[model samples]
Target chain A: GAGVSQSPSNKVTEKGKDVELRCDPISGHTALYWYRQSLGQGLEFLIYFQGNSAPDKSGLPSDRFSAERTGGSVSTLTIQRTQQEDSAVYLCASSPAGDTEAFFGQGTRLTVV
Target chain B: AQSVTQPDIHITVSEGASLELRCNYSYGATPYLFWYVQSPGQGLQLLLKYFSGDTLVQGIKGFEAEFKRSQSSFNLRKPSVHWSDAAEYFCAVERGATLGRLYFGRGTQLTVWP
Candidate 1:
């Protein structure tokens, strides 16, 4: 079966710019999550979506970050006026339900110069 | 808040040698523990997880982890090492009530030398 996939394996952008990262979860998966991994830091949760309800945005660092999922299959994360601090590997994952293990995508390495 | 700790930032082992990666966690209740491996240019892949019941759980790629409730530890181990196993290993602990958020450790980088 096809696993989760993310586009633009590597991305470079100037500071104050905007960027969008896309993810395609496994078929039939109902739970989606986004995380950020910095240089020497642990994976930081950004947002989560389950069954089309309001997504959990508490983990999102600031208003600059937002994500959307359409038809319960694909997701896109948008960063507005990105900063150098936003430079990191953005990872996406999906699970069958709340308690199951989540599978991850290869990630989009975002670099803000 | 729930948190995870991987005391050793890096570990080096020779091929065919035994391997152990330590993980410690802090949570209010019984925690859901997991080990994941991230190869270069790839996403994290689940190695194993511990929910309830058996203290020892087996996972993909010939890996296993043991949860020691008394010590707040869930260490991952393999009887022998392979060069392919060289990667970043992260320990994660999910609080029972948190639902979807997984708190991850800083990670341990394994170097397998032949």
Candidate 2:
């Protein structure tokens, strides 16, 4: 892809239900990142992957939230037993190897009702 | 811990007026700084970035930012504003040694009055 791509532009799930958001990073980019943006809040870092291995998962809000990336191409973020507070836009980004500017995707707007 | 601070939550400026957005960061060492703009119903777009070399960096959409190490500030500025420039602006920082983790500040909403 020319840039990072996120699927299911919007998702509305009932409270306590599970939801999955997907992100497809740019080709050959070695680093991928996930972030959550709540209303009137800054981007909260969630996790980061380097070549299919997650070196940083420090920002996952709870055990219910987990993510995985396979083949260093596509990633999935699963939120189990969603809560109202989990409603936010989930963003994904990818960058080249080493220190570089990341290109972002059109985020998935998740609404936990 | 690394963090970015954007003091102004909202700002209003008349079209054609000059504009400036302030940002500050706290990091152990010299950090990578960036400015991003998010328009309504759109994804974030990179405005500018600074890693090293010149303190001043230019970006797309006629945006520019200056990095000041003394104050740990990277402020975005434009000589003239446009109505289309109305959007939310965010400041972000990355730890040079750490690589991929990027920290962001609370955004600043800019309202351009015509």
Candidate 3:
């Protein structure tokens, strides 16, 4: 409500299991983004949503990674057959407009065991 | 495609010392630049942003960044460093206004020694 919110601050899953990470952007925000940060790495752009439609999904690592947004408010990232390398912090951010500063959430730490 | 480069992977500075973190970007047009800080176990917070204007932008935590179009750089600076300023810093560039795709650098870890 106040800022971007992400669920499951920490997640542990089996190597082949699938997992879903959720992101709730700030109220009235029109743009949302998802990013992945591996240990010792920078933020990797995963996707961007402009009013519940993803205009750019080029950053998604593989076909197994899919994401969707509904009602322009909440988004979910799904990973099928997770791998150990998938372990990282999944961050969500939302901006009032397309080209403005974005507020971020604490992120979901996913650890694929 | 756009990309960001941060030269220093890690840096150490004593408390009260001046600090500068270098960042460079490659984009087709005038890009939207930003600097973000991530403290340990915390989310990333915006330090400053540059879209257009004086080329100099001020941000919270007593930090400032200068955008040099000629050099394709947006370097972040602080007059004096504090121990609490120790964190990981990232530089990013918006590829285009329509796409809203952001390319981020590999980040620089700042360690302030007392």
Interface RMS for model 2: 1.3
Pick out the ten consecutive residues of candidate 2 chain A with the lowest summed lDDT.
A38-47
The 10-residue segment of model 3 chain B with minimum total lDDT is B94-103
Which runs of model 1 end up more than 4 angstroms from their true locations?
Answer: none
Each candidate's fnat:
0.78, 0.70, 0.62
Candidate 1 lDDT over A88-111, as tens digits, reads 999999988755698999999999
* lDDT per model vs. reference: 0.90, 0.92, 0.91
Candidate with the greatest DockQ versus the true structure? 1
Estimate, for each residue in A48-109, the C-alpha lDDT of model 3 and write its tens digit. Answer: 89998988888899999999999989999999999999999999989887457888999999
* Per-residue lDDT of model 2, residues A47-111, tens digit only: 99999999889999999999999998899999999999999999999989985688899899999
Q: Which wins on DockQ, candidate 2 or candidate 3?
A: 2
Report clash pairs, candidate 3.
none
* Model 3 chain A worst lDDT window (10 residues): A94-103
Order of quality (TM-score): 2, 1, 3
- Which residue pairs collide in model 2, if any? none
The lDDT ranking, best first, is 2, 3, 1
Q: Against the true structure, what is each candidate's TM-score?
A: 0.96, 0.97, 0.95
